[model samples]
Target chain A: MLIEAAHKPHERLGAYLKDEMAAVNALISQRMASKNAPRIPEVTAHLVDAGGKRLRPMLTLAAAKLCGYRGPYHIHLAATVEFIHTATLLHDDVVDESGQRRGRPTANLLWDNKSSVLVGDYLFSRSFQLMVETGNLRVLDILANASATIAEGEVLQLTAAQDLATDEAIYLQVVRGKTAALFSAATEVGGVIAGAGEAQVKALFGYGDALGVSFQIVDDLLDFTGGDAIGKNIGDDFRERKLTLPLIKAIAKADAEERAFWTRTIEKGRQQDGDLDHALALMHQHGALEDTRADAMVWADKAKAALAVLPDDPIRDMLHDIADYVVARIS
Target chain B: MLIEAAHKPHERLGAYLKDEMAAVNALISQRMASKNAPRIPEVTAHLVDAGGKRLRPMLTLAAAKLCGYRGPYHIHLAATVEFIHTATLLHDDVVDESGQRRGRPTANLLWDNKSSVLVGDYLFSRSFQLMVETGNLRVLDILANASATIAEGEVLQLTAAQDLATDEAIYLQVVRGKTAALFSAATEVGGVIAGAGEAQVKALFGYGDALGVSFQIVDDLLDFTGGDAIGKNIGDDFRERKLTLPLIKAIAKADAEERAFWTRTIEKGRQQDGDLDHALALMHQHGALEDTRADAMVWADKAKAALAVLPDDPIRDMLHDIADYVVARIS
Candidate 1:
């Protein structure tokens, strides 16, 4: 399955799309600047320079290159996607009161929530400006809808994150909104910009959607079993009372006593010193972790399968591997 | 000026553009809904339903009507402007840690900052969707730039709000960004959509820019002397340590003792009894309040003068009156 590889899929894709990514990075730096507001550039550079893998923008570039088109607008669209992502991350840190991101102190921590919120807003507006410069209404439509979906998904999560009634269906909807919407939009806009056929564009959207879902499930899973390699504190989501896949699955299969335990710890927000360990034990007892991993694998497979309609390009191979690598962390 | 009459200028414009304003209100209600996240609508409705005069959207409608625009997209643009304003207000409340707005409890205070931030983001995305539906690139560019400027202004205010070094020039730049940018965009887009000539569009932009500057100057003045008709607490800006136009003027004219008082109260954040009254006395001592009012009158005159290039229509007259009424609040 080529899943035994030691190197990262994104790094390989980054290498392949190095030139386009370099253009995207330059555009990002250029657009993030404000002639009047120096604070905008300051706050933005702190997050943009923090050195996360530029995966989303790369997805856009990969889709464009794979679609057999050469154009300048792809760089604009790639920068747009990255700007949207950075904006969302800045706002997300404020929403979650997160102190750290990508192994560094968050922008909200370094500058203040006001800076984070306002700078995030500036980036969102700047992204719109970049997308509008493409002069493609379809791309704008896809991105605008994806953005609305992303915000809606966030608000949905705000309400449903701790509710026990949030089943797999609601969780999937939330995941699609917050994470998958932008991912799918990134790929779909790239194909649309390249004047790809309807079938290929749809395929790109499908691939990104499935990959995003797989990506988020794995993220949630790693919050439990990721140890130090994930760069997030283990059980951080548990402490936040988030209804991730494993915990939801465990709760679904809980017996009376286990149900009481879940209700007390999660719903009531009454956690003791060893509650996280006990929650892990319960997830193991219910095989919830394995079931969650299986679900991520299914989504990853679907992501790979969606690429069958696209042309057989090297970029496509990397995209396929990216899907596998997203879930391979759980293996 | 016709603004000397009993009725307010905005009320007159509202009556003039009543039908178009109705459509904008309906569209706003329709677009603000989140089919999945009920919380979004709840938070949005709290702010939308609060009777805040809806002046920005009215400006768009007035500009379009003055340009003889009969198309439906003007309504869309008006609603777009309103949604953008509401979104910014929501975020501003969260950034300011504000407890009340427009004589009502703020969305942040009522729902929570998380809801305010997310809902604000949702509305911003929705505004983009609405503007994109118009299929006008120029409109998109103006609105997008305005949005970026608004955020930049807010961030600038975050840093400059309390600093004694903030001068009249920086204050004007900040005002042009936060307030005048939107006002000019609202009017410029209307002219662009209505097929107004380049001269007319530029004139509309100039008029809105001047009127907005005057409007904001009067608002700053009212924060000190407003007898409760302004729907905000007197000295609220002072309490928040905002370096408004009046305060900037007073700071400019401060002597040794007055400079020490300004430093102690504003820069050092040490407020004691009678500080508000003492600050007002100093402003009076320097004739800063009168000078600020004179500056507002000059801008309002400039706004009226800019309208001289446009068609001599009733809507144009109303806009001229709006410029007068904005400063008349201080009279």
Candidate 2:
């Protein structure tokens, strides 16, 4: 466990696919350039250079390599995935009205919401252009559907985020839309581009879907347990009135008094200074945090189990380890 | 000319392509719906049902019919174009912080910016899905590039909207990005999907591009001369401090004293009650409005000339007449 902790799954996968990742980065840089609107590039570069792990695109590369196929289009697909992710982040910051991201002032905060919105649209169109260049209709279908699902999920979250009645089912749907849709699409496109068979492609999709669910679950968990290492301040989801998994679980089992407290603080937005601590205490009383952590591990295990059908390869092994690592954060 | 004037080009074209346009409209209505997020359809239905002429989609239908298309995909392409146009308008309203559009309250005003932005994204993704269903990569490329160009043009307009240094060249670029790129794509994709010859396709592209330019020039001109007939208040552009073509021309010829007035009213956005009238007087002093009118005519003529390569079909004739009608609004 210590050795596994020391050598992270993403770092291992990144080292293995270093050259392909580099090409994806180069493409992202080249394509994000605007001949006329310098603000587009300025805003894009601020977020792009904020040092995200590039985890989504690596999933694309790893899936393609594991399929034992070689193609130039994977780089295009990988870059397309990254651009879509970045564009979503830009718009998400605006939607969330976030002031900080990745330990830096968000583009919306630094430049303005207008720049973030327009630049995000530019990046989205840019992603479509890159994907269309591959001339793969299937790839276009997956990514385009994923984009729509992501948007739909976001709209769902907008309406459901503050509603305490937003149950575990709605939470999973939002998680799938906002996070897992892109992950599954990224991996599925790689296999489709590499001409992988139906079984292998399904496995890749299943792996990505489960992994993404685990990743988001862990992210929501970290908003409670994440120290400064996570960059984001703790209790963000709670303060924002986001009814994530833990809160949903807690609310499900709350007594009449506890339900009133949640209704006042969350639904009514009448939060006080110690509301977070009280919320945490309620979560502890219900064992919601531990239960949420257990759920994330179940998802990670599903992700790993899904990969068993794929061929045995170093890249495949890295993907398996990635699933484990995602839940490891919570553990 | 009087009879031709009584029967406007879009109405005639709409009559000619009535069934196709109806199908396109139905498809649009069906696709804008959300299974989970009811807000997506609500906001979209508001703007989609608004009385705008649906001119861009009509261009696609007209182009396809002129190119002798008999396939079912033109309806898909037409709906796709409308979706793209509608999405841009949604985002544009948010960017401009606009309250009204097409004489009605904007989606952003009725709903929130968050709803507008997310719903706009949903429409864009829906448009892409529609276009990809055609399996024509060229159409995808054209529409995707146009989308990128539209976004770039918008960002350029944002930065240049208040700057006095924005010239005629930049204004044209902004106009092309904001208006013509989609027009050209709408028509170009129709021809591409119809398997039109290169010359015919180029002619279609040229016609749409010129028509879009003329359309926007007239829109800008009407802001000053349109009175209440144009639905929007006169001087709205001046109030917004948008440096449209006429104002750009007038500012170019400003004397030292007039330059200060222009700077204070436009560049610095310090407008008093009589400022719009003063700006109009300045434009008159320099013949800016007349010159702008002349420019619109030039573009209309260019649009007519671009149709020379196409067969002399009635749809082609209506397209040529539509170009004239766009400019006729100002004349």
Model 2 in CAPRI terms: which quality? high
Candidate 1 has an fnat equal to 0.81
| Candidate 2, chain A: TM-score against the reference | 0.98
The superposed Cα distance between candidate 2 and the true structure at residue B257, in angstroms, equals 1.8
What is the C-alpha lDDT profile of model 2 across B134-168, one tens digit per residue? 99999999998999999999999999988999999
- Colliding pairs, model 1: none
lDDT of 1 by residue, A1-331 (tens): 5665556778888998888888999999999998878888888898889878888999999999999878899999999999999999989988999878888888888888899899999999999999999999999999999999999999999999778888999899899988899899999998999999999999999999999999999999999997436348899999999999999999999889998888888889999999999999999999999999999999999999999999998899989989988887888
lDDT of 2 at B1: 41
Q: Which runs of model 2 end up more than 4 angstroms from their true locations?
A: A2-6, B2-6, B228-230
* TM-score of model 2 vs. true structure: 0.98
Compute the lDDT of residue A207 as modeled in candidate 1: 95
Each candidate structure's TM-score, on Cα atoms with residue i matched to residue i, is: 0.98, 0.98
**What is the lDDT for A66 in model 1?**
93
DockQ of model 1 vs. true complex? 0.86
